[model samples]
Target: MTEVFFYHLQSQPLEAALPTLVERSLERGWRAVVQMSSPERLSALDAHFWTFRDDSFLPHAPASEKGAADQPVLLTTDEQNLNGAAIRFLIDGALLPADSANYQRIVLMFDGNDDDAAAAARDQWKVAKAAGHTVTYWQQDPAGRWQQKA
Candidate 1:
């Protein structure tokens, strides 16, 4: 069975979540992929040795040098390339499909402020539930702790 984990990035930046997810995936020995829409943010991840491109799929490797095999693969889209090998794609709150078979699990991470984001999160939750996939919605407090409110 595939598992999907969704996290909202309203309280914290996606940068903060990346390392945590990578660490968790490594610990659990699970194959994981991450996708995002921000070029600047993607560049930042590239500096940290995360892979970014469209033609290739790279796994997350914390110890690899720049352009090494042991790096997290990241893909940047500009309307031309909308999707990559991402099992889960972290998108803006307003845009995401509620029902998707792209992967076994789908995670929705967003801030609580945006109304569209909230709506999408709820919709994704409903879809995942209906499809029998694991759905998780988390909110971060001022103290920087992720509390699973939903």
Candidate 2:
């Protein structure tokens, strides 16, 4: 069964938090696909990855790249897993893919400050749970550390 994790962004923006998660996924030897809802968001994320930090950057490519499947982390606006990834990250109001179980894990990150985003996450949580996926919820602390809430 796929494990679905809901990350409620409160303390920091997605750009600040996402790189760490992607790095952690790479550490676990898991390829990751980050799905967004628009090309503009995808492009921004692609550029952000290259300079998210002063010293290092996550190795990634857009799904439209020539060797997208060879990238360790792929960014796109589509639900298709171009890379053979073990994890899929849904962000920027991206809906849960119909083939949610295709990946080992599905991470749904939503802005807690956004009423619509929070509401959407709740709906996704219910759907994932109903589908028999192990679901977990996480919220950030004041210091920007994630704490599992459910």
The digit string of per-residue lDDT tens for model 2 on 19-55 reads: 9999999999999999999999999999999999999
The TM-score of candidate 2 is 0.98
Q: The CA-based lDDT of model 2 is what? A: 0.94
For model 2, where is the 10-residue window of minimal lDDT? Answer: 76-85
lDDT scores in order:
0.52, 0.94
Steric collisions counted per model: 12, 0
Q: Return the clash pairs for model 2, or none.
A: none
Instruction: Report the C-alpha displacement of residue 10, candidate 2, in angstroms.
Output: 0.5
State the lDDT of candidate 1 residue by residue for 1-150, as single tens digits.
Answer: 335556666566665655665555545544444445566655566565333334432354222234432333333422221223334445554233443555555455666677877777778677667777666666677766777865
What is the RMSD, in Å, between candidate 2 and the native fold over all Cα? 0.7
TM-score of each: 0.59, 0.98
Q: What is the lDDT of residue 87 in candidate 2?
A: 95
Which residue ranges in model 2 land beyond 4 Å of their true spot? none
